[model samples]
Structures are given as C-alpha cells and as structure tokens.
Target: MTTAPTRFAPSGPLTGTVSVPGDKSISHRSLMLSALAVGESRITGLLEGEDVLATAAAMRAMGADILRGDDGVWTVHGVGVGGLMQPGQALDMGNSGTSTRLLMGLVASHAITCTFTGDASLSHRPMGRVIEPLSAMGADVSASPGGRLPLMVRGLAPAVPLEYRLPVASAQVKSAVLLAGLNIPGVTRVIEPVATRDHSERMLKGFGADISVETDADGARIISITGEAELKPQTIAVPGDPSSAAFPIVAALIVPGSDVTLTGIGMNPTRAGLIGVLRDMGGDIETLDEREVGGEPVADLRVRHSALSGIDVPPDIAPSMIDEFPVLFVAAAFAKGTTRTSGLDELRVKESDRIAVMAAGLAEIGAQVEEAEDGLTIIGTSGDMLPGSAHPIASSLDHRIAMSFAVAGLHCRDGASVDDMHPVQTSFPTFEPMLRGLAEA
Candidate 1:
C-alpha cells in the first residue's frame, strides 16, 4: 500500500504514558520456536506488524496451526522437530529479512523443498549469508544471480553436523545455523568472532533445547546445539520493543519541555546500546521498576527534554543497536556538538542504505551531515530549529528511515515529511496514531 506525503510540525511538550508494540526480535523467535515444539504454546503481546505477521503466515503454511483470539493472544500447535510438511506453494516473507533467513534454516534439514519469496525490499537483501551456513549442513540451495531472494532450498533429512565460524557479526546468521542444527544427528557448533544479539540462544534454552554457550580466551563466543531434540512448549509474554520506542524517546528528548513515559520496554543488554549512547549524550532518561519478563530485562523509561551533546559513538556498540542508528542519526542532528559513528559496515546492507539515506535527508533539511562509506559524521544544530526541507524526504521503503524523519519533523521550523508513510507499517503500525495522540494530548 502507498501513502501520501504527511508533514509533522513542532508539537510542544509531548506528555503522556505511551506503550509501543511487542519486541519484533522476540516476537519472531517465540512464534518460530513455538511452531517447532509439541503441543500448544501460547504467546501474549505478539507484534501484529506486517513483518512479524509474515513470519506467522509462513509458519502456518508449514503445518503449524496458528490462531489469534479476540483477547490478543496467539496459540500455535507445532509440527515438532523433523516433522514439517512440504508447503503447498512458495512462502512469501513480505518485507522481513529475519523471517526469510531463519525459516531457511528451519527448512534446511526437514526433508522438504521450499521456495521463499518476498517484497521488493526483502528480495533485494542478500540471502547468501544464511545460505552459506545452511548449505554447509547439506541443504541444496539456489538463489537469484546476486544470491538475493526468490530462492529455493531442498532439505536433507540427515544433514551433516557443521562447525561454521561467522564471517560477520550477525544474530540472524548465528540463529540460522543453530536452527538448522535442530534436526541434525549430532552436535552443531557456531564460532562467533564478535558478540551479537542472543535472543535465539535465550529462547532456545527457555523452550528446552540442549544449547550451551562459552566465551573463549580471545572473547569470541562458541555456541553449540545438540540436535534430534524435543522442544517443550511454554507461555511467552513479549516485552515492548526498544527499537520502536526509540522514536518517541528521542522525540521527547529533542522537544523542549516534553516529558514522555514509555512502559514495558525490553532492556536486554544485547539490545540496549542505544539507551547507553543516549544517556552518554546527557539525555534525561530514567529507568523505573526494572524487572524481568520472558527471560529478558524489562523497564519503564521516564524521558524528559534535556540539553544533549554529541560524542564519538563507540564502534563496538554497533551490533547491539544496529537497527537503531537511523534514529540515532536523527538524535545526532539536534545535539550540541559533532556526533561521529563508524565500524558500521552492516548499515549498507539493510532494507535501505541507512547511512546514505539519512545523510542525504538530513543534509537537505538544513543539517550539516557528512556521509562516509560505512557511517556518518554530523555537525548538530545545537538545539536550533532546522529549516525543514522544501520537498518530502525519500524513505526508500525503509521503516526506520521513515520513522526517523518523522521524529526529525517535530523540531523543523517549516515542518518535515516523507514521500511515503507506508513503510512504518512493517514495524510500527500505530506510529502515526501514537504521534497524533501525543500531539493532541
């Protein structure tokens, strides 16, 4: 679906308690793991966004009986390990790269041949990162010329146990290999040179997998999973998505006198780098009622408007907040000094080239931004209202880019807008409404 250009102006003091959607990473894992277990698994707070729903649809097509009730709970009856039936047709993954890669792993050792397809955005993302690992486990694979989507995989029932080392720091690649290990006969090991998000490892343990993780002498992680195992079903309560919460949190920080409370956000250390970076910028963010939910850290964030100053973002923290850099760039544009970030080679491969997209958009809107091959260096406006763009910014079908620009609009003197708002539906379906609610309040 397409949307017309919508402009946003400075709305003073956005005050209210806001609850964002369920965590996308956790939500996708819950559904996939639930669909691989015996009996029924119930999940509350599943993200109903287009990307996550695409994963749900793919699971249902593979013989998992998935149902969502009027009470907002999702129930799934799995086909168990090595029990997935051949799908009747191609699996359409929509705009979710996570679904395509991870599902490829599940189908790698299932004795079934499946074809995966996706929208323009998802189809363009490289699938070779996942295909390489799964193929090492004996899956026959073929993809488009550039190893992009429109891919086919023929699983081998008795796949080989692999000891693959990650070439890049990717949670998706790490998770894909571990998932392919589920139906293999022996132990499958993955050597991670750099630490990434551990949602898969955590949720696998929660669902009764024989998974072990150890840190080596060199700080690399060695993760091993025993195959031919049975999975136990359990009730899962998803935490609020910190990635989605970033928009409003930064919104509250940049707009003077704005005070916003975001409740139930996931504070998983692997995904909390943005919070730490923002705090280091002198942002007024308070953690309230810290607790645990679904084996992950959870908290309510009380954010008030503050004077923010930019610093050199540590490159090591990039993996934790990979999905959040676009908004971080937005936050950087309003800071008091120069904000420089590097070691983000992965940004070039997202749904859109985030570094290029944000740099161009920010520059057009009167911010001094320098684009690099992997990252961007921005000279902030020093809390000054920017002379907003003459025309709408191009979002390039990226949800994060779309939302980041929307947040930038709140402080624009002439207001700001994007060519399309439809991309936000993939991760934050209520983003527009939520912003409207805050404005009206």
Candidate 2:
C-alpha cells in the first residue's frame, strides 16, 4: 500500500450530512467474539478499514469462515470455542494495536500457536501489557525485546484462571485477559483501577458469554467471566465510531459558518467524553435520535460553527476520550483560552506519542504550545487564527494525528500539510474524501 501526501487548506463553511465508519473497537470485538461462537454471526456496520480487515483476515487464517456481502453485511462461521487452528504463517496486524492485543488473548486459551507481526508503528508499540497478564493465565507468550511485536502466543488448553489487577487503564489489556478466560476451566477476573472502553464486556454478553461486571467501593470495575462457556452467535449492528466522528465535529466547530450533521454515532458513555468536553467548551453540538443499536447506545449529532473556550480537561475523563485528544487539541488551537490537560501518560505510548507529536504539530503551525510529562498546554489563536505551518506536520504514522491536523488545516489562514495521509485508512478509509466533501471548493 502506498501512503500519499495530502494537504488541507483554510476553507469556507463546511455543510453536509455524513456518517463515519462503524466503530473500530466494536468491529474488532464483534469479529473476535463471533469467530469463537458455535455458529455463524452476522454483523452490519462493521468498519471495513484496513485494521478491521486485518482482523477479518486473521480470523479466516485461524479456521473461521468469514465473508462480506454486497450490501456490506459480514458473516462469520466459527471453529467454536477452543477450536482455533494454528496458522501457517505469522499474523500481520498491519497498524492495529487493538487487533494484535485482543487476538493474542483469544489465541492464548485455545489449542493453537500463532505468531504475530505488524507494521513498523505497531511493532514499536508495547505488547508487554497484554503479555504480562496472559502469561499469568498460563499462556506461553514471547515477544521481541521491550515486548514489542513480532511475537508468539502458545495457547494453554484448559488455561489457568487468575485474578489480575490492571497496572493502567487499558481496554485492550483488560479485554485480552477476559477473552483468554473463555477457554479456561474456571473463573477469570480483571480488576481495573480506572475504567476504559467496555465494548468487549458488552459484546461478550450479547454473544451469550457468562460474564458480569461489579464495581468496587472505590469506583473501580471488577469484570469476571466464567471459563469453558459456550458462546452463542449474535446479530451485531456495530455503531458509527465516536472517535471517527470527532474529526468532523471539531472541524465544524472551528470552521466559520460551518454546519454539519453526523449520524449513527455511538453514544457509549465511556467513549463520548470528547463530545461532552467540546460542548462544555461552548461548541454547538446537539445529540439527536438517541436510541440503542445492537445493544450499544447511538445517536445522530448536529454541529454548527461556534465560538469555543478552552478549559482544564479533567483527568478522570481520559479513558473515555483518549483517542480524540489529538483532534481536541486542534479545536483548542482555534479557541479563545488556554487548554490544559494532565494525567495522560498513556498518550505517550500510543501508535505515536500523541501529546508530544500533537504539541509539535501545533507548534509547527504557529500555535502556542507547552509540553509536559503527562499533558499539554495549548494557547489558542483567540479566534485570530493560525498562520499555518511552513513545514509539514510529521504524523508519525498515526491515523488520528493525520486526520486531526486535517481538521486543523480547515481553520488555519494558509491551511496545513501532513507528511502522509495514507494512515487514515487504518480506521477511516474514506476520511479524506468525506472531509473534503464538507469543505468549500
């Protein structure tokens, strides 16, 4: 695949009704859990981006028969729980950290040995987070130095069940441990000190797993799943990714006279923090048609141009909107006050160091930016607008960073350029065209 360079320039009002791709997180879990069931599971609204496609391919490699219809519905025929077969080759995870980690857990308790590899960006991400807990569950896992990818997971038949406490708030790590419990003979539990996305828990229950979640007195979540349980196939309707929606939502808010409607967005509370924060900053965001879709909360959102004010982003909301921070930073750059954020050390370890990378991008585009160990302080243009960057913003192969800067370009006087836009295909394959559709010619 070739990564082409792309640029976005200051534009007039952005007006359109659009729907982003299906939720990447849910799409991954749906494919994973569906592949473990005894029968075929049908899925609609699955994000068909490269990352999710990689998961579909990986499942097929492990003996699941997966297909996509002309209408975009996907069907998965499972090899049943504990029925995964050894792959003839290493699973190339592309740029997906979620798929690599979650599938590791799924493969851990089965009677198969799978080797995992990924693109340069993914290979650099730390997999030790999943490896540590899974090893405790008796899955013999080994990775490259620093626990990066190009790793191997040898499943433990009748894996040992164990209680593990998360050292950090990560849905991937937590979900991996829980998924590993599927083939174990006893109870498996994950104690998260701070909650992250619960797509796995919600989807697993929908798939007929014996799973339950309880909250500790301290507001932490304790998730438990019984092992050796048979999972029934489900008809899953994946919701539009809230993370993907952040792009257009922020773009409309910053671009003058813009009014855009994004429909079918997931309203999962844990994943909706960006919308709330943007609204608190005085963005004209409205939630419409609130309802449930395949067990996930979803709604359509209408956003119009509005003056924004930066505020202190509470750290507790980090887990909910972590992926949106890059774009949120772009919105802050065009706001009227100082936006300060902290308690986001996890951002340093994403596909790229989002805080540092975003700070660099903002700084390059002539915004006032201060970097911190765990946070960033961005002083906006006070609605005066940025001069935009003479140098192209280095995206570092992160799709969010690339797309976020694309939104930034919409509000800059000269627009902005990213080193490469191809990374957008990882989650939102149509990002460029979709975003361009709303821009004035």
Candidate 3:
C-alpha cells in the first residue's frame, strides 16, 4: 500500500550501535531447505520483512508446517524431498524475485503444478533466465508474454538431469537449476562462468545434499548435485544482512561527524564487495572482531565520517555487490573527484530500472551524474551538501532506491523526500526507525 511521502532531513551526527535485519538470501533458503528436510528445523535471526515472509508463506502452502514462536524462533516441519503437494491456489510472491525464481525451481521437479504471481513491480521483471534451464529439465512452462510473471510450471516427476551453463551471473537462476536437481534421478550440473553468491551451495551441503563445486581449467565453476537425496534438518542462525547495512554505513560516512557501529553483519566474500569499494574510496570503515557465524564469516563494522575520494569501480566485482549500487551511487555523490562504474547491466532489470531511477533521482538533488547503458559516471560534490530535491523523489516501488536516497538526504541542504516509503517494508522494515534512533543518538 502506498503511504504519504517521507521527508528525511539533515541531522546531527549519527552515533550508535545497531544490527540490521537477517540475510534475506539466506533466510529464504533456510526456510526452503528446511522444509525439504526429514525432520523439524529451527531458525533464528530470520528476516521478518515482507519479502522473506512471502517465502515462508509459499513454503507453508506447499505442505510444509511452519510456525513462529513468541520468542522469534521459527520452526519448520518438512515434507521431505520430492514431497511437495500442489497448492490450492496461485502462489503470491509479493514483490520478491528471489522467492519467485527459487520456488519455481522447487516446483519444477515435483509432481505438481503451480502458478506464480506477484505485485505489479515484480510482474514487470523477466523470469526467462530461470525458465530456460528449468525447461531443459523437462518442466513445462506457460509464462506471460516476454516471459514475465503470472506464469505456470508443471513439474515432471523423474525429471531429466541437465548440464547447463549460466548465460548470466545470477545466483537465483543458478539456484533454480540446482534446486530442481534435488529430486531428479541423476546429477544436475551448472557451470557458472562468473560466480555469484554461494549461499545455495553452502546450505545444500549443510542439508546433506551431494553437492560439489570445482573450478575448471578455464576458471568456470562446475557445481554438481545428485538427485533423490535425503535432506537432514539442522539449526540455522542467520546473520545480519550486509545489503540492509549499506544504507546506515553510507550515512555514517557522508554525514560529517557521524560515527556508527553495525553489529554482526554477514561478511560473505560474495556479498562484501561494497566494503572493499568504499575503503578504496577513502571511507573510514573498520572491521572489528572477525569471526564465523553459521558457517559464514561476519564482523562488526565501525564507520566514521571521513573525506571520501572517488575511484573507478572494477566491473568484475559487480556480481558480489549488485544489490548495493544504488547506495554506492549516493556515496559517490558526496565524494571528491569522479567515480566511474560500468558492467552493471543487471541494475537495469532490478525492481526499478535502478540505473535510470538513481541517475534521475541523484540529478534532481543537484549531483553531477552521467548515465550510461551499463553504468554511471558520478562527479562528486567534494563533500559539500547537495541542494535537496524540491519535490519528492520518485522511489519507483524499490526498497533499496528509497533507502539510498533517504541517506542522501542526511547531507542535503534542504533535506530529501521520497514519494513512497512503503517499499522499504519489503526488505528493511525497520530502516526508518533505525535511522531515527541513530539521528537521536
């Protein structure tokens, strides 16, 4: 539901310690793989945002017994491998592309047919990437024109194992194929030319799936998973999402005199690309107490306001921090010199055309930006305040875009207003409250 425009104004130094929501990607997979295991599995630190909740709902619809307790612990009773029942109605994915694509993979190898639908924003995004590989495994697909959402998939029991190569560096598409492999008769293999997040791979091993990853001679990842495997239930502790932490970390950097400590942020190598980029640009972000949590590396980040300089962002790291480009663009706006970013065509296909939306929104607030087909060239204000947008910035129903601009407003001379803050609930529901707490600190 749309709400009144939210105004974010310049405030005093933001100083405090806080923890963001759980890892959305891991939360989704935890519920999913847990539902496919033999016994009950418990999960703590799961993200309760709308997107991850949508995954929980979909899993429940497929015959998994899922419940949350008063203590914030979630328990899932499994239906076991190849044990999903046909949903009585269409699976509503809300605004989550991850749930839509990954769940489609689960439905693709079972003896059931399900229709996937979503909100207007998600309906516009393409589903063809996952469809291509799932179809090869003998799943019959009937999709809307242009392979968009409101699509149906008829699973083929005893589905053929497939050897597929990723056309794009997308974890969702790769996971879709791998998930479908779980119920097939033999091994299903995916060759990833450019590696994305490895949450699926790690979780599959933890769940007792016969999955292995090998780096071929040409440096492509060969991921193979055997079918007809029994999954073992295990307790999971999800870590704080790095993506959600991006906004506060950047706010601390760009807002003068701000110092903030973010606790227990996931430091997955595949997802921590933003930290490296920011450090290279001279942001004073310190990592403290590096440790392992739930099989993933994590740390506390102490971010202090510092003079920032711009540098060219390497394109190869795009897969690792793709979700962070919006806030990174905002960070670049306040830096000194020019920051050039390319090879981010994935941003064009996100919830909004992030490249276009960010470029337009940043320009409206008086930042010097050049938009390109694949990336942006942002000329920073050299740590000067921007003249905030005279009108509400159109958020285009994107959570990341909305939060990124809200951070941008912290250093704006006139403050910033977003046309809709409703979208933030999809990922970081506590974002506004957290920002409020930090400003009050």
Give lDDT: candidate 2, residue 342.
96
Whole-model lDDT, model 1? 0.93
lDDT of 3 by residue, 122-236 (tens): 9999999999999999999999999998999999999999999998999999999999999999999999999999999999999999999999999999999999989999899
Deviation (Å) of 380 in candidate 2:
0.8
Provide the lDDT at 374 for model 3.
Answer: 99
lDDT of 1 by residue, 1-441 (tens): 557898988877788999999999999999999999999999999999999999999999899999999999999999899888899999999999999889999999999999999999888899898989898889999999889989999999999999999999999999999999999999999999889999999999999999999999999999999999799998999999999999999999998888999999999999999999999999999999999987999999999988889999999999999999999998999999999999999999999998899999999789999989879999998888889975999999999999999999999998897889898998999999998888778
Least accurate stretch of 10 residues (summed lDDT) in model 1? 1-10
Whose lDDT is greatest here? 3
Q: Give the winner by lDDT: 1 or 3.
A: 3
CA RMSD (A), model 3: 0.7
TM-score for each candidate, following the candidate numbering: 0.99, 0.98, 0.99
* C-alpha lDDT of residue 324 in model 2: 95
Ranking by lDDT: 3, 1, 2
